[model samples]
Target chain A: AQSVAQPEDQVNVAEGNPLTVKCTYSVSGNPYLFWYVQYPNRGLQFLLKYITGDNLVKGSYGFEAEFNKSQTSFHLKKPSALVSDSALYFCAVLSSSASKIIFGSGTRLSIRP
Target chain B: SQTIHQWPATLVQPVGSPLSLECTVEGTSNPNLYWYRQAAGRGLQLLFYSVGIGQISSEVPQNLSASRPQDRQFILSSKKLLLSDSGFYLCATRGDPGTRGYTFGSGTRLTVV
Candidate 1:
């Protein structure tokens, strides 16, 4: 079965420090990977996506993700962490064969000031 | 610009009560509509999706059912609510396969008592 996995349930980082949220995916054929952030009581906001081409994809809110086909991972990263960036992050992949997008079990990111 | 709207922002219903949540997309035509549920501390689970009017594909078998009577209107309904159904529900629309991420609405919080 096609699936996405966020190994960490929570990741903590101090403000101004670099942060990473790990994600791995299993799917048939090329994968369309995405990252989304959810604030308290709000719908998910798209962060970035890696469809094709460049391995490093940048998106809204100064977030970026590196897509590695060999490792089957698309990890979200930020150069510097911010208190406002603390939220639930989800990794997703468009499963073409299943005709749906599958999401990982999310990782809560906490940035301490 | 395309926008998706879902309402009501929050709902409290009694167990066994019928439920209706509506979602509509603006500034887009014949777009793919999707319904997703996010339980507390969990990832988004796709409920249903529609490519066109009257075309609904369910991702999971559950008490919830979805209908698309118009091109841009998607409705999620349940004949009877269950305590397990209380969660955050989100509506999303995808336009142009080239688009990287789906546009999500501001989500609805449903609480079953």
Candidate 2:
């Protein structure tokens, strides 16, 4: 079974500081990883995805994620956090042969101004 | 550009009332459709997926059911509602491998009392 784990339930960061939301995965083969963000009472918006190529993948809204094959981790990162960037983040995984995508427990990101 | 629409934006129902949430996609064809639910402060739980019309695969056993009567139409229904079923329901669609990523609807907030 393919699964994703988001270790932190919440992450707090001061504005202008860097922020990280940790994510790890378990899959039988190479994984297609994606990160999504959700604002209050809204649907999730796609931020980025990692299919192949460079480990560092940049995404929408000045966000990026690094896919670490050795550590089986795909952590979301931002160089500078903004108060408006605070939202719920989810990490998801899907193998090429898999018909469905599995999502991890979400992490609530809070940026204090 | 592809767009997904889900409604009603907000719904309040009694414990035993019937429930139905509809989703439709535009500017695409033969897309893979999915239904997901998010409880308070939790990640997305995939409920059902459809590869084509009248083809639905359920991921979990619950009070909800889904239907794909048309290529761009997906509907989630329940014979009777439960308080536990109250949450935000989201619909998503993705094209074949060439598509960039999944597109999500605005979401429907259901509150069962």
Candidate 3:
């Protein structure tokens, strides 16, 4: 079955430090990878996506993800963490053939001031 | 600018009660719509999706059902609510023939008592 995985349940980083939220995937064919952030009870907000071409995809809120085909990973990263960036981050894979998207278990990011 | 709207930002319902959640999209046509549930702020579970009117495909078999009465309108319903159904429900949309990521609604926080 096609699936996305966020190995870490939580990631902690000090404010202004570089942070990374890891993600991996198992799927058939080329994958359309994406990252999303959720704040409390609000709906998810799209961060970035990798459809084709460039491996490094930048998205909203100063977030970017590196899509590594050989490793089957699309990890989210930020040059500098912010307290406001603390939230639930999810990695997803879109199956165009199946016409649906699968999400990972999410990683809770905490940035301490 | 594509947008998704989900109603009833928060809802508290009793067990065995009927449930209905609505989602609509704007600024796009022939869009693919999806319903997802997040349990305890964790991973997202794909519930249902619609490629077009009257073309609902369920990702998981559960007490819930979905309908697309119009091109841009999607609705999720349950005959009887279950305690396990309480969570953050989000509606999302992706444009057809496009590689962009999905746009999600603000989500509905449902609590079953």
Instruction: Give the Å shift of residue A47 in candidate 1.
Output: 0.9
**In candidate 3, residue A9 scores what lDDT?**
99
Interface RMSD of each candidate, angstroms, one decimal? 1.5, 1.5, 1.7
lDDT of each residue in B39-59, candidate 1, tens digit only: 885788889999999999998
Ten residues in sequence with the least summed lDDT for candidate 3 chain B: B94-103
Candidate 1 stretches greater than 4 Å from native: A95-98
Quality of model 1 by C-alpha lDDT: 0.91
Clashing pairs in 2: none
Q: What is candidate 3's lDDT per residue for A2-113, written digit by digit as tens? A: 8998999999999999999999998888888988899998888878888888999999989999999999999999999999999999898876575777888999999999
TM-score, every prediction: 0.95, 0.96, 0.94
Q: Specify the highest-lDDT model's number.
A: 2
Worst 10 residues of 3 chain A by lDDT: A94-103
Docking class of 3: medium
Candidate 3: C-alpha lDDT: 0.90
Total clashing pairs for each candidate:
0, 0, 0
By DockQ, the better pick of 2 and 3 is 3
Q: Clashes in candidate 3: how many?
A: 0
Instruction: Sort by TM-score, best first.
Output: 2, 1, 3
Tell how far residue B83 is off in model 1, in angstroms. Answer: 1.2
How well is each residue in A1-113 modelled by candidate 1, as lDDT tens digits? Answer: 68899999999999999999999999998888889899999988888888789999999989999999999999999999999999999998875555667789999999999
- The TM-score leader among the candidates is 2
Candidate 3 TM-score to native: 0.94
